[model samples]
Target: MEEKIHITDFLVIKNAELEIKQINVLIGPQANGKSVIAKLLYFFQGISTEFLKGIRSQLSKRELDKAIIDKFESYFPKYAWDGTGFSIVYTINDIQIEIHGQAKNKTKTKLSLKYSEELKKLYTAKKRIFLEKINDNQLEEEPLRGRGASEASIYRQHILVPLRTSKYSDFFSDPIFIPASRSFFANLQKNIFTFLSSNVDIDPFLTDFGSFYERAKALFKEDIFIRNSNDKQLIKNLYKAAEKVINGEYEYKDKQDWIISTKGKRTNLANASSGQQESLPMLIVLCVLPILKNPNLPKAQALTFIEEPEAHLFPSAQSLIVSIITELSSTFDLKFFITSHSPYILSALNNCILGSEVLGKNEKSTERFQQINNGSGAPLDFEKVSAYTIMDGKTINIIDSEYKMIGAEMLDEVSDHFQDVMNNLLNME
Candidate 1:
């Protein structure tokens, strides 16, 4: 199903599209609301009316009112409302899921979900169960609706499961609103798992080299004994992959432990490098493995958001990362939304365009390139790529060096103005 999510007034984003497979790279100076856009798209589900209702019930009347007012002032600077309320609307596969509310009082919010055929089925089944439980109690209406609300009375159990399942996990797992203090530790644990278990083949080496018995004989200097065990061979292969970027080879002694060989001696990963250097293995593992393991996930009709992927890597690595992104999009059914401040990453995308042109010289490939070069022919064509620059005001404007704005055809004046600014910046630096 094609999925499109539109968020309004939840944060810095006034309105924006969150869709999959197409890479939307947001670039601008600091405080231009780039991170705000990421937060809205990634946490759309968590900001729903149901979740907000629960939050309001936990806060004091004044605190709840204050929170609502603050979110409005921050998200919509030009507009102000005396009312305390927020809403999120999500459209997926022709179904509209809307959750909206306004503060009914300081301690309570009037919240409701706009039901669809899909949600209605789940809601009906749950409502029936809730009514059966309430009928068994035979309590007074006022007390049932008031402080004695049980779990079954307060929530529709079946409907609640749908809200908490994997389909809605992204809302809570979003890196932006989900507090970095807790997420940092969670992410670290996930990274460690990827580092140890990913992309290592063991069975082939074991069968070809006999097994543990052959290795024990080799230690006694016996002829025809296995030269290397399966564990050692796997470690050697891992080391070779690491050596492609780092200075030395890495060895995995056990499933949980790894050692790096520098010079002629072996050292634990922690002791092999300083604290700063030790962190690279984890970063590299996280950045590269996610794409490798689920290269086809983008094709699954879900949006994927990545923020500042160019952190803590050299220029060459950054270029390679962009190439990986380009290759994955072309080879799989995926859309990518990425944000970056690195000029090198942008230049790498530019090279993808140029490289495609150069490779189209052959008559057989020329027609294909022409189709992609012309936006009307293919949905994934290069023309579909757009770059937006966020201006000093909250407005985002599109700019391309190759095209002149309509009614601005004086090339000489435009060139002079650009050169003057470039000279001034250079002089200041």
Candidate 2:
């Protein structure tokens, strides 16, 4: 069974359904909060207590607590939080979870969780405590300063996993939260491989290649020697799916720095072209490892979120990336959610749909294309892919490639529309 995520009332993804092997592309104008949506989801899994405390400074304790409670209630049956005075209701694998949160005005917020029968009892007790503390007179006591609000506690309890080109250690751990920054790519060349090959007693040069070397050796029927060949075959393959080849080599002497030889043999990752050069390594990290980590993991069940994958590459590279993502989805139990402003990426995705259709034309062709029961199988339809444009005023309108309107706004839209509803509820004495 695939793990599905239904996001409601969080960032720009008001109401979005993300399933495995599915590619969800968020396209539209800039500053439309695509990054915000991505950040929220990345941090949704295991929110840290420290981060939650930081967000508490924005709203009153009563209002923040209610918002947190509502969020938990929506995801019920799958996951739960207890103690902490915050509650979460979401289902994963048929199991129900109820999250609890604890906040004492400006004091530190504590979090706890419950499941099944225990979740209900915990929630009831929390609800009573929360209501009892909602006295209007407490408003003058100066809402929780700093990271001690109920909302902060709730956010800290749910984690967000980010893959960016910047340093965000407060949120991610090594091999878990991958930053898309230049240093991150450089580190992949230096650290990732060595960490994987720690158990093997191979030569130092081979050891420097890390897990990538092992994976390459297993995939291709040949040895990838760093110094002996002097040819660019291995480097060529690395840049095979990429547009421009900046420079990639296994460096010796400097165990810490993995040199990226860009234009004019300048051996610094900082010197490489901005977009594609920066994007290539991130793509390798985001795409390849997830597949290698769990071979049996279903493509239709995994959710991979990428932000601005079209960062640095030519049109061709962008197109290739779209194809790679599509192929990955088709092969593994994976679902891809990416935010892009590049028309080339969108066009490439459209081409995948067309290509699939062409292959589904005949019985033998269809069988080859779908790999299922000849022409009787369903053709590859891109319509199953959903795209949304987040508009101003918190309104998210679903649109097609040509900006054609697709009916059915998500619950996020409803919440945005009823902003006054929340304001009124919070203001009620």
Candidate 3:
């Protein structure tokens, strides 16, 4: 979309539009539609990829238009698509993506995936499809027409992680998400242990991330057995990422029904401290991303969506998670969408942008700056990051990485007063 989303008559999105970014951080009070927006992006990205699965070997203007419209039915009728007073648009390449729906009697859903320059909708119809090539650019496009034919083929090779620990655990097989209630993952250790040590074909999304988590755990389980010379490098890389984040390597002890080894001590994943239970799997996943060079899956890219990775972590540890992701993203190809309420992470992200603005400069290399950025070895480029706040109906970018500054847009509204009160109490003058 235009890096901004506008909503009215929609849930909590009364009249707001947000700018989207590579490192999209959504922060706002509870029930303010932060998660809704994040999940929408996840869905849109999934459908877009699904819709683009078979490329038109022939990229003629008309050919491209026809091919895109043909898949329209694949994305319509989203589980939560029934609504009105809503409009979302984003332009990527030559295509403009738009979704419109309203709440009224027999509300209609209209989605526009229009080619801006051609002035032609993919499908045109009186009420159901957009099929005509129009001459005017000023005509506001309507949303999704009736529905395209449902094609099973359109849903293949798609990965969309929802914001639930168990629901999206399967995605963790590829290190995609780290949920807020990370500690809750322990309850699944028993099930996961069974899935790994047995020959069961279970649905991961059935109960949340199980498919992926079990499979990922199976890798660690296999690594212990397969220590083959061919795979040692990849194995080392995986654990190295783990060690970097946890300050200790990770190993699973088959004895006592799936225990994790950290710092030479063995403990059941369930028995690990709240911090360990919450942070361990997430840390391992972080470790898994950069080091996971040659995965068995055919997927070329990974999009990770973590909900409150700061859970149960100390301020320093939180920054470490941010830093490791930052370092790997600097080198490897990884996309992350995180939802958080932690200022530590917000400020750390701001510093990432700051470091980027003055990389290699004497000031940035100073010990103080380096310490502030201890989480990452590489300077973070804010241009690659987009921070937003949902306190308002719109998602607004707060960190102007280009200026090396953090805006008040995302700070706690009471933070200003808090600062003033603290300053007066301390008598800093």
Candidate 4:
């Protein structure tokens, strides 16, 4: 089963085709459609959730179609719809879905959808059984508005359980988008859910991110009381790696997030540094991944979209953050899709790829790789890594096929340009 996407005439993106991979990185300047592409991927990958929503609500074919369209429009607001027209084609495991958007009138826009027969057949069969169960009063008619455990459990039992045994199970994982404005939610952690519920003007992506952020934090509210020592040690190692990135140990107290420094001073998020505020939410997720993967807790596989993970950090810290990601990815069933403006993060990822290449050639270099950066290094599968840079309504692959890593020249171009400016100024005398 192959996974790929084609997007054309969408926002700043004129045309782009990307092969989805385990480690996908999109690097570009601001407003060059990096986030736009990320959101589109999120929306399409999340079609499984929409399908479940359709069955749970007993939506008709037309109603389901409208629901999906509404979701797409919500992600791309009316202001973003100013584009003349757009089309997106997403294929995974041979199930293809196409969406075309056009301006129907000045006041309205219509999104036309075409789904593969496999998807339609699966949805129809599931919906039929769901309707039969409802008619027989064999399943609870749980309200989905709460989005609480009961609703999740009901859906999992009715839909996910069956899908898990089928060939389409790979499509069931949820796509979680962690937006660049994650710090805003981190600062409002105490009241984010209430604020989001009361306010409708906030971006839908932020709302979803806030929810996941909250869950990640809650994972650390209590102690990790696992019986497995290896699992426990892995969590400790991950948290230690994360601490180097944020420059402090994270603590949750009195229903708030706090950071304890090396000197034992405690600073709550409100009084903490901007770096902490910006990095805390992402760091918390890094800390919680292993905990969620524990056999005791309910485990879930997810396609995680991380936007500007290097936001408000030094270059060394940025490298450490990438290390944390690689370590977790190596250990867990998570795939990371990263969007970054920082070449430091990309360079750090390249280091991981290079380490993998070295190890691939000579297994004896394993010890040498571990010696780099105090054992923070983790080897990546270069085959599963893909990098692209977006500009001028297009994306260019930056991954070097021969080297099996992002090319050094691509990472150095921006730095080299600024250095040339410095050199000219120095010679002005």
Candidate 5:
């Protein structure tokens, strides 16, 4: 699949064609459909072999269709729909998979799978997903429901990390989400675990972070966080990044169940400072990526979505965290889709872009990179990074092919306004 996702009138998203890259950054004002776009990508990427195979077990095509619709409603919420519905299309290689969901009833959703002309000639059903209801599920070849093993396999290879703490583990393994409100993790565990453990048919978008935190914590046993890394320096870089985020270093003590040690002081996650709490889960998740799967190859791609990593952090730490992500992206072959509202984050990214350009000419970028990167590792590869800002109901790409930022007026204006305010105060003196 080409890393681009085309969304048409899905909820608040009127029409969007996002060309996602290895490091895609979405920076926009709140409630402008940024999260919606991320969630849509999550859902689409998650429509994998396991998901399709699960639907195949259903007795009727109607039941399968209903199941898919219900999943979408729960995953994305019906209220986001602006009554116009949505048409999402993904073109993988030459085969096309299109999903049309009407915001109204939602039950009126349609999914079509079209193959290339040459491939169409061989398949019994050129375009699977016949609107005609097949009476018997067993006899009706899966083409009736746009089912294909190869296509599912193609999608399943791509992973998505939506990073919404609430529904963290709904699709993936346990402990998927690490929340921004991690400081209150202790209280959250009590409430969220109760909800997750219950039989209630809650929405998938609704998650209990505490429950997922416990799950994520469980994955840390037996050097699993440091499993198969031949790169000692890379692992060191990861720790160095983690150390920069937290004011100090921390380790998970499995025996006490999430007890953390920092500067020889022992405390639970709740007792830790806000920055420590915020950075703890992120630090662990970053280290754990290499160990998430075994026999780790150099080419494996891991897609992770991180929401507002700057939460509870100072400006310096914010820049450090972004650089750490940059280092990890190159180290682990990770594809990060981050959503942020932090000016520090944007400025740090800007520094990275500039740093890459200067480094290409062999001029020393250490000072420039270190200042913007807040003392982190290698500069970010701007070519792999695509940044977009949502304004007036549109996600606009800020950088061009040469990594020149086009729409930075809003950030500049804010800084100018701050300077003007400072000058006004000085004038009184």
Candidate 6:
């Protein structure tokens, strides 16, 4: 089954349906619901993580439902209502999950979530059998006496272990959402978690992203971040490309992030340029991906949602960042949902898709193409990519079928309008 998400009457988004792909990109003007779609996908794809935890803690169905509702509310504040309600249907593999809500008292939203019946049955059956064994004293009794860490461990062994390897596993891999406000966390450094704890009203998504960023940064405390031998060279190239994007190599020294420039000048993160601050957290995560491990879903493909990767970046730098991300995706077998408002980002991705086509035809042109792509191996299969423009409460495909590239018309719209204004001024003169 095709993976996709359909949203209707959701906040600023009147109606939008996106066909999810390996390299999904949404590009349009600001506040056109790009981030809304990204967050919805993040919330749904991450359901597996929460569901497993609910089962591990032996939560009743009613408790689990309330927990999920609360979690959803945390990601999306109650103020996003549009005087009505919304519906979201996210389909992945064999699962068709629906989230429908109704507005109440002009301030509250009542939500009802429906997922695959198989999952519900599985959860119930597992819980029942585990409880039966416990009642019969067929399992270890000491762990049950405390009902603490040991009991949780037993529950994991009985339920979570099988759930991880079951057919539902693919439906439940982690989705990392890197918000546009990521630089805020970078500026705070180690104090980010502390800040989040003190400020309880911050966006839950941003808070979670801050926590993930902290963990990613922690991976670099050791001498090496890449533990896989086969991927060492590829991961190293990723770091080199990332350095070019931020215009400096990142160093974790004295418990602070430092940027060491090519000219031998050193500046800590707080003192670095805004561009560096905006781009460093993302670059760090990309560079450290090789070492990041998930024991539960060890073989699942990683899904990442990045908002405005071009923030505070030069046009050329934006292109380089796109190349680095595309190359990293290809190298790590990861999938990305990226939101951007930059034409340069689209142009860069077009180059990647075209590079893949050109190199596939002529192996002899490898070195030349490498030079053009800045040695980032910036080649992406066009078939694996999907580009969309969200505007006027609608989603439109911006890829040109014949050219096998993102349509130049879409990327040149703003430039063309400005060019017309220039022509008019010249005529007046």
Give the TM-scores of the predictions, in the order they appear.
0.48, 0.48, 0.63, 0.89, 0.73, 0.89
* Alpha carbon lDDT at 163, candidate 5: 18
lDDT for 355 (candidate 3): 74
Q: How close is candidate 5 to the true structure, as a TM-score?
A: 0.73
> What tens digits encode model 4's per-residue C-alpha lDDT throughout 82-182?
53578899988878899987877765556799999988888888888766654444344655444455555656667777775467755766677878876
Model 3 per-residue lDDT at 255: 28
Once superposed on the true structure, which residue ranges of model 2 sit more than 4 Å away at CA?
Answer: 1-21, 44-239, 243-253, 256-266, 296-301, 362-384, 393-429
Model 3 residue 279 lDDT score: 73
Off by over 4 Å in 3: 1-9, 52-83, 104-178, 191-208, 219-248, 255-263, 291-302, 363-372, 407-415, 420-429
lDDT of 3: 0.53
lDDT of 5 by residue, 1-429 (tens): 245778877666777778877788887777787877776666555543223344334324445445556666677665555355568875433444457754444444433333235322312131133212222333555543444653443233322222111122222322233334555554444366686588777435335444444555666443544554566556666676776676555555643324434556666665667777777776766665655543423233435667678888998888777777777776666677777778778787777767777787877765566655555755667778787887666667777665365336757877999999999999999
The window of 10 residues in a row where model 1 has the poorest summed lDDT is: 174-183
Q: Write the per-residue lDDT of candidate 2 for residues 1-429, one digit (tens) a residue.
A: 333344444433445444422567676667776655544344343332222332333334444445544443443311322212333344434434444345544344454454455423433444444434443325546656432464334333322222111133212221222223433444454556676677744332123223443343233212333223333342233334432323344222343333344443435443445763466444454334332433222221334666666766677666556655665555443456777776666666665565565765643453364333211112235655766656651434354445222222442454576897888888995
Q: Model 2, poorest ten-residue lDDT window?
A: 158-167
Model 6 misses residue 316 by how many Å? 2.0
| TM-score result, candidate 3 | 0.63
Q: After superposition, how far is residue 22 of candidate 3 from its true place, in Å?
A: 3.2
**Candidate 5: C-alpha lDDT:** 0.59
* lDDT score at residue 234, model 1, on the 0-100 scale: 24
Displacement of residue 145 (Cα, Å) in model 6 is: 16
lDDT of predicted model 4: 0.78
Q: Which stretches of candidate 5 lie over 4 Å from their true place?
A: 49-52, 55-67, 91-95, 103-185, 190-227, 254-262, 293-302, 363-375, 400-407, 427-429
| lDDT score of residue 368 within candidate 5 | 62
**How does residue 58 of candidate 4 score in lDDT?**
78
